[model samples]
Target: MDFKYDVIVIGAGHAGCEAAVAAANLGSKTCLITMDMNKVAQMSCNPAVGGIAKGQIVREIDALGGYMGLITDKTAIQFRLLNRSKGPAMWSPRAQCDRNKFIWAWREVLENTPNLSIWQDTVKEIIVENGEIIGLTTFWDVTFYAKCVVITAGTFLNGLMHVGKTQLPGGRMAEPPSLQLTESIVKNGIRSGRMKTGTPVRIDGRSVDFELMSTQDGENDFHKFSFMNDGTQHLKQLQCWTCYTNEEVHQVLREGLAESPLFNGQIQSIGPRYCPSIETKIVTFPDKEQHQLFLEPEGETTQELYLNGFSSSLPLEIQIAALKKIPAFRNLEIYRPGYAIEYDFFDPTQLKHSLESKVIKNLFFAGQVNGTTGYEEAGGQGLIAGINAHINCHGGEPFVLARDEAYIGVLIDDLVTKGVDEPYRMFTSRAEYRILLRMDDADMRLTEKAWKLGLVKEDRYELMKSKREAIKRIIEFTKDYSIKTALINDALEFLGTTPMKYGCKLIDLINRPQITIDNIANYVPAFKQMLDEIEENRKEEIIEAAEIQIKYQGYIERERMIANKLARLETIKIRGKFDYDSIHSLSTEARQKLIKVDPETIAQASRIPGVSPSDINVLLVLSGR
Candidate 1:
């Protein structure tokens, strides 16, 4: 077989899948190499996708023509719109997926993608000559040449799995570690560190006592992650069960502290802080009496169930003993025991905004290998890396998403600017312009740009244009249409809100927190007629988008103004190879950080942890800003 390619993506997890598809779809010949092709896009930690800020990233990925949302919508077993009680900016979509089906869907998409090939093999070392990536060598000693290489190795580099005192050399439960690649990269001047993450034990569903737990059913109203189709409508919904761990269970786990891998120093690396293990939660919050655990099904055909929020690395006997203490798990039968895995990750500060390694040209790193966690974060980086790898190979300008434009941008910026000491996960709080980057408006924010960059197809781009036009028409209709106060008094009174004193613009009424388009549509005949005139398929989204735009008009405008102000800083370019040490007026810490990160823009330099406002002023003056 021919071994030459434009891009070689190492790994087939979420990052690798997106990266391969992106490059191939952009007309570059791409090859995805993995140890096990059957496990492509494996939900290593959870059989789910999208949550909080993560949902926004997924939506953004979909908007950019990435396959994650499409595949997720097709395989999801349950769906819910989180934070519905909150404003539109806070609302996020999350899905509980059928794990096996999710992987199958990804494999099918990859196999069918044009110019993309799948190879079942482990990448042993990256081949680089001088300062640029040339290709990679597999374990079988076969060398494949490529112009660029995207490494999404995930938790396989020098991986070490821990369960109590027993240690194993594996990336996951059954997969072996990638030692040679890790060693080669380190020797190539790429700084690396260790990170720890754990997964919950799988239990047999037949042994679970559902009567003792509360049933958490899926949303009755269908909501999908992908904007391209209505695939979520046809899936069979599944229910999850919730139970609590009392002080008794905690005491049992405490007894196993002597043998626990986390406490016994068998695993010293940091795990995800937000999704801590049950043992860590118990010890960290000792005053709390109980912690909630969610039982999620792995798949429809399989009897295996995931014990969410109960991730642990204690001895198997102790885990069973603790499980027996819980009323709902008295007869629990284990499918597999939970274990913690420590893997090598490179410092993201060593990379540019395009996710390309500064140490080596045409070499990119994404996903867990960049010291970040979560499927969405990995997919976002992979998409960017894949797109940029193609761009770099074809002599095109690097494609980058600004911090104001996407959560993906915020994630990458944070990683490259501040540098992570622990495993970093995305949260809504991380993005200052989240109001402008809402999940509902991701397509409006990114589709046009992606289309210009050749990532989005013409059909999807046309759909996005039509959707935006529909939203515009709806917003204008709301502003121009006026409703009589007397006619709407009854509905307003029914809602327990103050009635309008005179004829008010429909948009003005919508600006009230208590008043919604649906509520107004019932009373205003003209508004209901206007909604009917809109295309039936486009009605729901148009109404929702119009409401958000009208209701939060002021806040959205303010955020845009702030973003515009910050845009100037980004326009002031800082040469990637500029000598920061020559700026004698800069602080010592700022000089060190600037030299280390070599930020490409003044705005990026300002975001670095050690660079102060004074340092930014110095940079601005030096750059003639």
Candidate 2:
């Protein structure tokens, strides 16, 4: 094996996988080293991918030539488009993936990817010389060299898991913690903090009472995470059962609170606010009758199920008692109890927009190690880090995505700009231009940039281009084509929406909330005929994308204009141009924060927590922009 490469990615979790694949595909010789070979892209928390803003991030990953979306599509057992009642901006594609198959699928891609190698080993110490990364030494005492290194250690860094009074040192269930890596990196003058995250108990399906729970079926549609998909479902479809926790369940959890690491002060780190433990949930919402839980299948053949929304760090027996209190789990058998793990995370503010360390050149950070909580967020960072690491090695302009351009961009900007007080999770509300960052248009927004960088394959790039062209045709046809009220009123009234009073362009009718290209096509045969001219494979997806653009054209354009206006602030370069402390007009807080953040542009400065709009104006005036 070669001892040297252009980039080496430590830890093969979602971030490492994307980083390694991205760098390698960009023609960089990349090596992805991990502690275990079988657990690549392991679904440590949940057996699902894409939710809320997370689904948008996954779509962006696919658009930018990352492997997560493709791997997820191949392993997904059940698929659903979340936020269906909402508009296009909130529509997120989620999939219940086969956990084991997900790992196998990711491994298959990593193994076969060009210019990439997978090595099973723990990275112990990163070798830095003169403030630049050179390589790293593994736990097995094997030394490897690289021009750039991305540390995506995840929760493995000094990992410690707790369930009731029992505490164990492990990354995941059985994996050993990477004990020295955090210390080694922290000594490099980078700030680090501890964060807590937990998972729910696995269940034996035979013990679950399906009759007592409401069935949540997956959506069968053309919507999927990756544009590269053949739009075919891979694994056999399965049903997920939804149940709720009653007061009886809460009483048992309350009784066990004395021993819960989260409450008893056994754990000091902060956990994810959005995915709080069952104990936290009960305590936080005392008046609520029940909290929802989903029983998701682990794989096609396995009876093992993941108990979502029941995450806990309470006693194992208490966890069982809580589940048994619920009618569905009356006869519940279990695989393993839920537990919380505390691990090391670096302050993301220490990293640049490219996810490279500000202090150490060419050394990058991604994933949970950057104080983020989900697979989607980690993969987005990995994709960017991998791209930048290659560029850092070979020399090019830093690739920074604006917040309006993508959810990935918003995530990185928030991380590098605001840092995190707790484990960060993405939500639709976080991105201001979410309307422009719709899930259906990830390819339209990002694929061409990736293609130009040589990260996107020609075939995929061509497909994206073809899809875009088809969508444009659909939009144009809708704009030009008109329909009489007599022809469309019956269909509209039948659908329980207002009937048109007069003739209108097809787009104007489709713009109505109740009207959709799919629904309207059924009534207007001519519109359906035009849609049929699109490629058969992605006909539905293209039509939907076109419809979204048409319906939200006004909102999308407004958001785009706002985003563009703010983007001009991005061009006013302020970094390294001012000694913020010397700028007397800037507030003391702004001065301190500006010096600390050292934002590259006035727009980034404005987003920093302590920097006010007035401070931004001061910087703008000082920068003569």
Candidate 3:
């Protein structure tokens, strides 16, 4: 059998779903091929979405007209803004999703989308001709032709799961591994490496002693992921419980560490440094006598609880022994044993900013296939790759987000510039301009760009424009209106804020650390009425933007100037064939690495590990920029 499509996206996980939708929504004849249609967008590890820097990626995806935020909002059982007490830059939106519902919603959305088709089959080999990827052949001997191919085959490329000494050739639990794709890519000269990740054992919620552990609940004031569901009601949330491990738990793990796959050479791939498993953490941080274990509810209806921060690949008997030592899990019934899985991922440095392979034209990669870890990171990258693939096929300029512009920009830039050795996880610290990339204004910053490229709908663009106008009006109102001590003295004193010595604009007063726009709205009925009419997301957005403007005005402007300077460097484009070896002024290491990577921009070149400021200055002098 033979089929033709404009774009072919392999694997229907978060990355593949976003890629397919992005391409299809852009009017490409896109086909999503997955091994199991029933497991499309499956949350293989965790059932939660967004946290810290990852939340910003989700917001960026929403702004780019991707469906993740919408599906997350639709299926979320609980929502909260993490780091609420911190600055606006640190505040990130997170949600606990019903896993089954999340995947179902994804399938429903994909099925309803125009120009997108779903195929239930495993991709066996990529068909490349003259170093250009043309299509792929499935295991069943079906050949599908495409102008561009995106591989988001997350954790399924020769995937192998390990539980102590027992090993299975599966992607997750029961899913079969793709047999020949890894070999096919290697034959094409694309470099690949092994990476391992693990998930924690789940316990039946009915067997756990919730009374003995502290309950972790969502905030009283809820915040959903999508701008579309700001005011709508979602499902009622289930509570999560927290417990801690004592010395006995550590002892049990230590006694069995000799048999662990991660430590005993059964697995050689590097795992994520931030989200280490129980055995790794115990061995690495031995000074800490206890580790916290969270019992997160899998769904509102299911009695299964996800054991967060307890990921392990130790023997089953040892896992049981360790759990029995925990205060709240003395009589815990085991549901599933945690295991580690190793899979093949490409070296993302081989890809251009468009995520298209430099070695193979029209071939792209996303998700864990590119060595990224989180659902949001994969989704964000997939959306970019999908959009760019569609654009490339149309003879349009590639969509590239810069470091200072958005978190997605930072993510891609970092991946292409400085390739990660371990599973790459997003954190706010990774972005130098996190203040400018606030979650509050993701749509404001990126939607217009996406809309102009025909990725976002007209109505969504209009909504973003309207939001900008409202935010402008609110900022002007606060700037123009002054509050006299005579009017606000009592309320201010009652709230323990310093009473105004002289009259000041309400906006200026709101810049105070303790004061907020919401606090003053209650004092003025007109302010309350004005806000009540706006969309809740937009309202929060306006308030947050106002607060940031007032508080970090100088810092933001300084960063903007710095970004502007860096943008000038980005304007000077270089080819991948630039012979850095010919530049005698550069250091030997810098010259060698530059010759090997062949960075496209001076900005990217400067970010290479061994490249120095003097070398960049030499490049500027040589390029006459």
Q: How high is the CA lDDT of each candidate model?
A: 0.90, 0.91, 0.88
The number of clashing residue pairs in model 3 is 0
TM-score (all chains, Cα) for each model: 0.98, 0.97, 0.97
lDDT of 2 at 281: 89
Estimate, for each residue in 320-345, the C-alpha lDDT of model 1 and write its tens digit: 88988888889989988999999999
Estimate the TM-score for candidate 3.
0.97
> After superposition, which runs of candidate 3 have C-alpha atoms over 4 Å from their true positions?
220-222, 522-538
Candidate 2 lDDT, 243-316, residue by residue in tens? 99998998898888899998888999999999998899888998988999999999989999999999998888
lDDT of 1: 0.90
Query: Sorted by lDDT, highest first, which candidate order results?
Result: 2, 1, 3
Q: Which stretches of candidate 1 lie above 4 Å from their native place?
A: 231-234, 576-578
The sequence of per-residue lDDT tens digits that candidate 3 reaches over residues 1-625 is 8999999999999999999999999999999999998999999988999999888899899998998999888888878889988878898988888989888899999999999999999999999999999999998999999999999999999999999999999999988998899999889989999999999998987788788999888764645666655566667877877889999999999999999999999998999999999999999999899998888878879988899999999988888899989878888897789989999999988989999999999999999999999999999999999999899788888999988888998888888888889999999999999889988878888999999999988989998888887777777778888787898888888777889899998777777776778888788666677778777655776666666777788888998898898888898887753578888889998998787667888889999999999999988887886
Candidate 3 lDDT for residue 374? 90
Query: Model 2, stretches more than 4 Å misplaced?
Result: 484-502, 522-525
Most accurate candidate by lDDT:
2
* Sort order, TM-score high to low: 1, 3, 2
Measured on C-alpha atoms, candidate 3 has an lDDT of 0.88
